[model samples]
Target: MGITREIGAHYVQEKGTTFTFWAPDAEQAEVVLHVNSKQTIPLQREAFGYWVGLAEDAKPGTRYTFKLDNDKEFPDPASQSQPDGVHEASEVISHTYNWTDQNWKNLPLEEYIIYELHVGTFSEEGTFEGIINKLPELKDLGITAIELMPIAQFPGERNWGYDGVYPFAAQNSYGGPEGLKKLVDACHKAGIAVVLDVVYNHLGPEGNYTSSFGPYFTEKYNTPWGAALNFDDAHSDHVRNFFIQNALMWLRDFKIDALRLDAVHAILDTGAKHFLQELQEHVNHLEQQLHKPFYLIAESDLNDVRLINPIENGGYGLAAQWMDDYHHAIHTVTTGETDGYYSDFGKPEHLVKTLKHSFIYNGMYSEYRKRTIGTDATANPAKQFVVCSQNHDQVGNRMLGERLTKLVSFEMLKPIAALVILSPYTPMLFMGEEYGEENPFQFFVSHSDKDLVEAVRKGRKEEFASFAWQGEAPDPQSEETFNNSKLQHSYTESEKQNQLRKFYKELIQLRKSVLKKLCKEQLEATLNEEETVLQFTHTSAGLRCVINFSDQPQTITGTQGWQLVLNSADTKWGGPGSDNYTSGVITLQPESVLVLQAKA
Candidate 1:
């Protein structure tokens, strides 16, 4: 029997409750229910090292733990709710919910305009309920999806969610499992899909006792977090099933529309059937059963096309993957910061390559890695690449967690927004980027262990040495650091920020109404190295965007029959408002972008 049926705590009022666990290493396993009275129930060992038992009194809200080998007690590895904490008992949760999203068919991949946000910092409440109140705002902004930073249970009240230990349980601080369901249901009603970011590379350090129950992780390979999961090692089927079921739980039970797999490059697997391929197959089956679109998007830096290719084409059949080239190219060009990976990107030609080929280093020699990198991805549709101007990793990993808004000239922000939103790919906006939220998204954690806290602080400082950033690094353990990371929501009161907000809304409106229907072949770009200008034109859509990256104004010849649609230099958008054009020639202000359309 598969571990899927026998794992976790399943409750049926009439049939009592069924509790199961995978404990091959133990001679005995017992379910210790914590209720009015502690009742110890022994589980009968089944095939494939799975143990199963029936408890007459166990029901929804029943707190319990597992006693392995009839000795040490540990929280359920398949816990549905850790209402107490990671180190405490797990509570049985009912899947029954008054879901009103029965007709909520997911949007297609090309139509996805994802807004990535950390729920803990998105609002002052920092709970799932808090995010629900803000869904209509995102929907009004033309956001089709809200990609949340992980919600899996981790230690304490603060984390980026990458350190989640219990993949099955929603964080208690975030209102637990029930709260997440309410949020998902609310999102559907608001016409916004939810994309969860899940970390499968490695579990967190604290309260991670999966190894005590079974060989969940292998020492054969080392990940940045720690040891890689035992995906291709001995008893790998159980380990793989553990995570696959977790994915299913979120999709089937929580009704999540999509999952953004974090750091697939770190998930080392050498088996003939890669874990991703198998996962895709399972998700495909689920999609067919549910009659809804289910997507698996990966965050990979290896530039491997196989990760997103169809299984029939000898690939994993993922829907899309995060493409960082566009961000790196634009960041480097706007900031002129040639350090680390940005050293390979920054040129006008590089940005042009990113626009044309979907990758800047497609089979080219990378100066930073000192090696030829990336496979050809020109055959893939633009929608297969998800581009963003800013994301958590690009911002929070910095020495000061400074956003592009802090680094680039104010005039440069609009152009960056235009390129990302109008590009022939799915575009994502980091939380608070729409209105230029000035809050720094620094790396902060809430670990209880003093020694572990100190180690994390030291490690964070050392990690920035490679970036060569100047100034003192903020302490990750400091409360001030975490407090400063919260969203201000003060952009409404500022004239410049409000204009930026309006600028983003208009671009998104244009993207959905005009750009999505434009033919990919009609897109073309011309880069002027000498003038530091870029002209991107969409012939079918009768749209042309010309940007000036230089510190001084530059003249560019516009195509015949073109008229101004939007101007980055327009005074309405807080610029010098340069809108005058001499028939076929236009002078763009320093670090400004202008959009023009052919007169119908």
Candidate 2:
């Protein structure tokens, strides 16, 4: 194997441009080309596991794959883009599209109403082009930004994109590089920003050939998946650059507005200057150069506000982070699943704590960890945290991959969605969550090695049992599992889906209208731990939403001329029709949420 480059940004004048991969451990390595017909162009080894080649003709729009150890092919270990599905050939693409959002600035973290979805599972087509077709639908639903699950190339055609072998490559199956660009451009044109979920904690099991050429991973730390990245080990500069470069590449190459980094809690680095801090610095620079707003959303189990604190304040300076505690608190209360991490979240006091402060475990004892978990919230701003009721991880981690849609009845569902979207913090929706699709997001793997696939299946089943689940696990290798996960487009036409869609549309619009004013203010939520009643008072565009999350009919005094503007129990939300609460004090039914218009 032969190669030489430290993220070498090169340009070839003759055959377009070319990138090389070196596999010294293998007998052969070939560049599978999508130009001049699909063919494998031979790669020549040079110095130290380095491979070299030239295909100046391999410019943007050209797709190619890498063949290693003779017949075993893989997405390029260094592939920066993928437009096709994950298992297909890599493609050379150009970010040469026109962007009309020259004056479009980020709407601030507090105002964001996010919808989290998997590109493959979002629609029946389950591809980048597929999501593009539904931009209008998302826009109509009033989502400011759509957060797509990981798109990086993994072992199979379908899996949670977290097991990415090529951290840089887009999944070839989801419409490779060019296809992704089209989708992003379409999103921008429709005024909807796209935020991609990325995995930086650890690489997937198969096709992970990074360590062969460089010090990409280390045995010093271990993640649930496998070896940890060499973030703080010797020769760490190269490793750090590899990941930092990847983060930048997605922003610049894909025109992605934001990145949702998966499992940041799993990332390891003990240096004085954390890699996350360094990454944030680079993103800030890119933001300035692009003259456009950009963001970083972190997923962390640790509730330490330290992750979002400014560098000067000893923080990572992330724009926002997923508040898993919020989910734990709500889900535990409703489902009463007291196993695993839910054990610490069962008490009603946990729900009240989170509702009041956005994080219940902030600098408190955690029975699950058997220690004091989380540091104090920055008190700086709650907007730095993103709260959600459901997401890919929570749904897919289950044995049956059942969403709250199937677990909780419609009666109790609307209020939870309302609490999340209308709260003081930003909100994210899992794919198929709006319409309540019932398809299970089963675990699927497609390893080329038969033995490895068997091992994965066995391990997956054992893990599910730990969570007290039982059933015949889906064979990830089967095409049926992937097909089943695809979002059924027919649901959008059904009355329930359409009704839920409209209700969400109204919710997002209401939040935006408020964002035009209350950008950084904290509206206190007074929650009653016993009754499960929460009253929130926030000033928004000459209105105030005093919501009730209780289960019994109750009335409270209202401000003069205050009228009801929206209700979760409305006909539009597929809830039972209720009497008007448009004037004075009104009685609210069980499991209902209400928004009121206050007299100025």
Candidate 3:
């Protein structure tokens, strides 16, 4: 008989419960149940290194552990709930949930205005329930989708969710599996889609006992987080299935609309069928089975077009990928910071090129990397690239985790928002960016191991050595660092913040109402001779936007028979009044943007 059961603990109404584990190197395996009393059930060794057994009394809410060859006990590698912690026993969780989003279909990729947020810091409660309370506010901001950072089970009560050791288990501190389902259900009811960020490149260093079961890691390649996952090495098929199943659990069980794969550049594989291609194939099958649309987006440093290309075109066929060049070009031009990777940027023409073409360095020489980088992504559709001015990595990776609000002027912030939202691509916003929350999104952790805590502190300091940032990097192990990163949500009280929030809402509404119907191919961008002014026009919509990037007023010619629609320098958005034009010659205010449309 073919086995179609799930890899971990699965409960069937008629079959009671069955425990399946993969321990190729072990001679014996048993499921140690911690129900009312200690009970043990021996598993029969099956083909291909799988051990299968049944515990008649095992049901949901039962805590259990696995023992191999009479050795030390360990939590299930595919555990669904690690309630106590990563080092403690795993609890059996039922995949059943009273979902109200049976009719919830995913929003089109072009209409996605994603708001990326960390669950632990997005609200004062710092739990899944807390995020549900703010859904109405997010909905009012014109946010179509909310992308959550990883929620996998990490070490302690606090983490950025990247140090997750348990790939399948939801964090116990974040109200566990039950809490996550409620958040997803609530988001769907509020007409918002949820995109979950997942890490598959490497597991955390602590409480990672998957190696005890089988060859889940390979020595053939090394990642910055240590050993790379065994994708193309020996016994790699099962390892690939393990993670592929994890992806399905989120989409199938949790009803997540999309998944953002973290750091795909670190996922190395040399096999004929690349891991990504295989994953895309499986996700496609799942989409058909579920009869609902699901997306897979990747966060890769490499500007490779193969990630979003069609499978028949010899590509991975992912839905989209994060475009960091858009952020870098805009950031460097606005901030005037030339340190580190910003060395290749800092020119106004760079942003203009990014606006016209999708990438600024498509097969061009990169001084930062000392080599030619990036493939030509000109043929890709605008929606295949997700652009953002500030994300977790761009803000939190800094020595002080200062956001753009702290670095740029108030007048400059509006133009930056205009550039991102009006650009011909899907836009994402970091948490607290709409109203410009001033708190720093610093890197933080709460590991119980003192040595690991110290190592993290030292590693953070060393990582910023190349940038030559001044003061000492904040200690990642400190609780104050975590507390300080929480969002204050004070936009309603402060005038400047409320104005900024209103400005963002208007831009988002304009994007949906005007830009959504326009053709991406009809977009045109040009830079003046001095490269201080950029003029972008959409021929299909008969709309034009001109931005001045310099501190002084810039003179630019406006199109004839065009009427002003919105101006960033208008006094309504807390800026100086808009400038006037004579005979089609307009003088733009310092660091301001003007939007105009051809009169009907």
Candidate 4:
């Protein structure tokens, strides 16, 4: 009864290709194969509102569309390849590929040092092939996992990929489904697991035809993007199956080791079994069946510990959740920005609590939300929380999309890197953050609808008005804005950036090897509010990270036999050599950090 067998177009060499669609509301359905000699084949309606037929003329590379009610023609809702456009025919793609990762095993969640990158902006080429050529660079940089932003098909070539309308199809502009598979296969060969960001809460407004096919969305609840998905509605089984099948396709067909569900807080459902739990169960089944380790990381703003709690404990059983609290606490302190949600953070105590516990607001009053929020996540493993100093949303949603490199001094950036990589939680680095690329990650989209484009432009302006940020918002519709967001690959060629990259690689090496044993039980922190100096200790591991945020040299004493393992102020790490520590005291330069291993 699993819907994965034959939901989309599947090719059988002898029988050619068979197309299947779930259109319960349609009076009639047919397949319009857009080959040189166009052929229309009437699909026999099956039980449960499914229309199925064999197109003997259709094979891999054949373009086709579904005709509903004998009148309207639209691309398959479960399209795998939209080569022309979202509005055009869905191409039949062969899943066969020369994959050499049959013996590849993905790293466990605890070992993940994830590097999140948008395929379109990670390189100048902005394609899956472009990303393949850089796999060695990421592998050599010590990245265990690569998290790609949403790659589902949208309207045009330029998009952050959140506007994806075709959940199953790979963006035609990004070289379609085959391109994504090649990238995934290549990543596995390089010993890097791939975590794809998937949006299931709501579909984009443009080129969305799922509603016409069946009850795919519900008006009972609304999401920030649009109407919420039909998870609890009356004909919701197929709707759930639609998404379940999509997730399966990515995991089973593409061999992606993990999925990062975007904004789980936005997914509205009142069902007895929440869609998240159901999806988790499905993933679990796949893991057992395929004998592969899989993970599901949720991006939730609700601060609900239940999202990652065990399934037996009446929770969603997610592998991990994004620890935005850590980012907020770090960003507020380093940049001293107290606007928006940062107002809830910025205190040394706030960061200390986040380091000790996963969430600073666990069962505490939130002034920003004007209510008590979150539950204790301290009991969860440190790896259950994915922490990052900077990500796409934190930077792209800003007025000018200024990265951490733009917000803080070169000396300040290393401490930020150390705080994240050395933390107990799983660490994720935004693309180019390792080498300190100066280019901003501005939001850009290329929607074909003129009216929708204007609406997005206006909405962005109004959204930033509340942030109280200066300067005009960049045009999301402009080619220059998209180009500006692309990372400068040549930045690492410079002496300073090359050193920073080396620093990141060394930190990653220490994390995976020596620091692997670090746990919350071994954690401790000493905060000096007056000098803005924070000393965090891993007592059991005999490790300590001393950070100086003050603008002047600060002295910290009482370290008898601690050996300086790594220092951000070292000349090798783009710093004016170490300030030097002697006896039981160490002099820390302004805006520098030091990692010391206590001698046994």
Candidate 5:
């Protein structure tokens, strides 16, 4: 009955509904409701370019559209459900739900072991209900939180979700509003928090009609996708309210535990109060009102600590952010990839520096950008940075959409996993990385425009020029491409795959047990002369991890008091067993990780 009701259609029990629209530019605005009969209701213009109207005959399940100035009708920009598609009418939905997670409490930020997955490809069903069925398996896999790729309503049945046109609408193909609520409810029941990926930088090219109502986008600054969102332009007050309300809708109405803002670096805003800072302030108020924890994690390429820094320190006060440098350092080292951004990495010292300090490029000159980049983030806690060896962008953005399993050997994945899970920062895993999923998570879309489809394909091909990857990119508009990206889920049948899953589970168990009590200050990482051998010590836990990144085995010293806790190269983990320690010296197998603990 507050901000949610102020925008979009709000249905009142046994009392019909109230419809609102923001169309300052339009001379007229009317709600064309599709009920038992075609009903046209004119809305009364309100202050600050808003139109409000009450329809007693309209109730939940009523489909309608807003016609502006005798022009073509358009779906609600803040639509709760776009059942017919992005091009069709919007349906009225009730926010009421029988939530059983009243007593559900979220895990601390440090305790989050995030597993990021795309809903459409995560399961064969490819629905919210599909994810519900897999909740038990995820809970068992030591995943404390599941970060879903953007689920806002996109053009068609399939998309990576960055093309979402309706920011407030639940993707109709993914079971719409009711289905999303059910999945969130189920996740909480399984002791898993839900982190939703949201794109606030720019709307999709197709089916974007927000400009028809008012100045929703500005031509002043352009984004990689299109014109940047008008956060600091004229009529920006309503534009800011639109996105802020959308965030509130996800957290308040759907009960999402956290939001992973997609590409905040592209959100160009030159205002007194930054959009991110303002959004965080609103979320803080909601956290107080709900008496629960809700976090905002940003995906930013800028490498600025101001995003997670406290508001008192002239920062945004976000809980966490995705640190891409950590992934780049690890990927370049393990895969021997030195293309594009990876060229800035590949040195073993880069990974060592990343392990010690979350940002490898903190206030340093970046060879890739040919400019000084990043701010010092060493003052921030390790939990404020989410590190992953493989994520959606890293895997899918490749020319072939290849995962780490495709690029690196089976043995190499163990050390990469150890580096991410055992590191001081919060760790995240891409879907199927736990069990060595072989399927590629290719990018796919279902847009209606044929010309736009061709443009997208061309853009993707051109984007790979810098990486210099050979061959053509898979067709994004092809249904076969989307189908090819689905997880096989047959890891249980494969011996090696199941073993990899077991290895991951063991590492996660260790992280939750001994490593959980250790802070960033207690962690120290060092590299040998050739930089092929890497070792990190957890002083407080008396735990040590040694990794061999070279093709051949390497010997390392200073292990007299430590006993073997876990050996990834052991025969049990589907690897050739390495030689046991002798007289404080040990030979680490090629591409293997060793975990040791102080003997009692």
Candidate 6:
């Protein structure tokens, strides 16, 4: 494990750095210098499945690729940095680069405003460098943090990144490891924190060779992706250390502020002390060392508050978790569809339950499952929950991958977005939701084997067959399907898009300005079922969110002294209002929401 430099390859490791690679398939490997082909170094292979090479010359910005068989140049399966496509060589990155945000250490989870963005669809170039162009755009729109989708190595030059092959390496297509550093550095300088979305539940299908190298997977625990990681089996310490170290690398070396672990519910670990709790403990130690506020957010569907509760209080001590119930309540009520898990939701009482308590399906009989399931979330506050109307999963799981912008009218979308930004918990916006991009975010893949591609096609079809979605599923392997899902950035120019954008910015700005008190305050909310209007009065001062769900205008009498802060009905955002509004009792139009600032 300590043999990186003897072979003359440009690799270096220090207190804050470690270089890794996998290549049992290669006879001999060399790191070819991009500047001069003559300057080459050989890599040393060890008993394990790894090849090691060390050279201090491997400074950040140095371009190189491993040469297999002393002939064909292929991207490093472990390449941390790739400024070009995966087929291209890797680039060296320096964490020693200048950082500007010395004062921006920690943003409390309770006070955070999360904006989720896909690097590819966010701009035309769709690279790490490409997103630098829009940093100010996000900051100007009142976003405090930018949560990026997965950026690890995948098969093609472009993908949704769930099917990643190299969990540690940056995506070769999106400007590799160095590209990521530049993006994070730029974000910190802009005073906007960067939160990374990391997939730890399962490794992607293509370019996967972890199993051949070591006891990386277990036959004991089976995951939907394949073999689950062996957390409890023999020689599991090293395997657990691998992922734990990866988490620390992102927070310390990459200068990442927080990590959002994807599909934590799928991580089937049965150790005495769960792996999540252990990982959290290690991260806390690292956080103390770095003296920075590092956060661990999990994507869980267990409906258990123990995941977020403090360990001293008998919980895992995570910062927050993605609130699936919040999405279920809003989506089922607005869309009026009760299929699958949505069947347990859509009831007005369910919406009220989700608002008052974090979990709606807490030990209750679910009509869809025909069983009582789920645990209570009473152990944590509202800050432990992340509320959202539409996320990548809810929108992409559909047969057509239709977004809220497509399923509902402009009026409906405005209110839905209002509900997201003005809610007590942290709010998440899908990439193009602020601009109302009508493009679908369908599932796409890039597998080299033709038969495997066909298998995926069939699997996708059968997945949706049981639900309401029935249609010709997009050929995941096809380039057309991938391109179809790529967001058309020009939609931000359309009137409806512009209005939604402005409304989002206003709502976000309002959240930043006036909702400071509610961030820490926990409260219950409800809707008058008979009036078809939903209302939330936060016991914590300064927030009251009211939405008109039915297709009729309803006025509230008792709600006086309230000034309209964010209205989706403004004409600029294509609302019915002839003139923009400043203050009034919510004359809520159909499918509209009003965010009012409580009287001081």
What is candidate 4's lDDT per residue for 130-213, written digit by digit as tens?
A: 999899899999998999999999988989989999999988888788899999999988889999999988888889998888
* lDDT for 196 (candidate 1): 97
Candidate 6's C-alpha runs over 4 A off are 1-79, 82-94, 519-524, 529-531, 570-573, 578-587
Candidate 5 has a TM-score of 0.98
Q: What TM-score against the true fold does each predicted structure earn? A: 0.98, 0.87, 0.98, 0.98, 0.98, 0.87
TM-score: model 6 vs. ground truth: 0.87
Q: Give the alpha carbon lDDT tens digit for every residue of 1-600 in model 1.
A: 223444789888677789888878789999999988888999999877898999988889899999988788899988989988889999988898999999998888888899999988998999999999888778878999999999999998989998899999989999888899999999989888899999888899888979888989899998787788999988888988988999988999999999999999998999899999888888998999999989999999989899999899999999999998888988888888888778888788877777778887888899899999899887888889999999999999999999988998788899999989998889999999998889899998889899999999889888876677999888877788889999997777999998888889999998988787643467898887594999888888878888888889988774567888888888888887785776788888998888888888
- Which parts of model 1 have CA positions greater than 4 angstroms off? 1-6, 518-520, 529-531
> Which candidate comes out best when scored by lDDT?
5
Clashing pairs in 4: none
lDDT of 4 at 555: 88
Superposition TM-score, candidate 2 onto the true structure: 0.87
TM-score preference between candidates 1 and 6, better one: 1
Q: Which wins on lDDT, candidate 2 or candidate 5? A: 5
lDDT of each: 0.88, 0.73, 0.89, 0.89, 0.91, 0.73
lDDT of 5 by residue, 1-600 (tens): 112326999999988889997887878899999877879999999888799999998887899999998878999999999999988899999998999998897889999999999999999899999999998889888999999999999998999999999999989999999999999999998899999999999899888889888999899897787777988888887888888989999999999999999999988888888999999999999999989999999999999999999999999999999999999989988988999988899888887777777898899999899999999887789999999999999999999999999899999989999999999889999999999999999989999999999999999898898896887799999999999999998778999998999999999999999988656788888999989999999998988999999889999887898899999999889899879777698899999999999888
Per-residue alpha-carbon lDDT of candidate 3 for residues 298-373, written as tens digits (9 for 90 to 100)? 9998899999999999999999999999999999889988888888888887876777678888999999999998
What is the Cα-based lDDT of residue 12 in candidate 2?
A: 45
- Clash tally, candidates in order: 1, 27, 0, 0, 0, 11
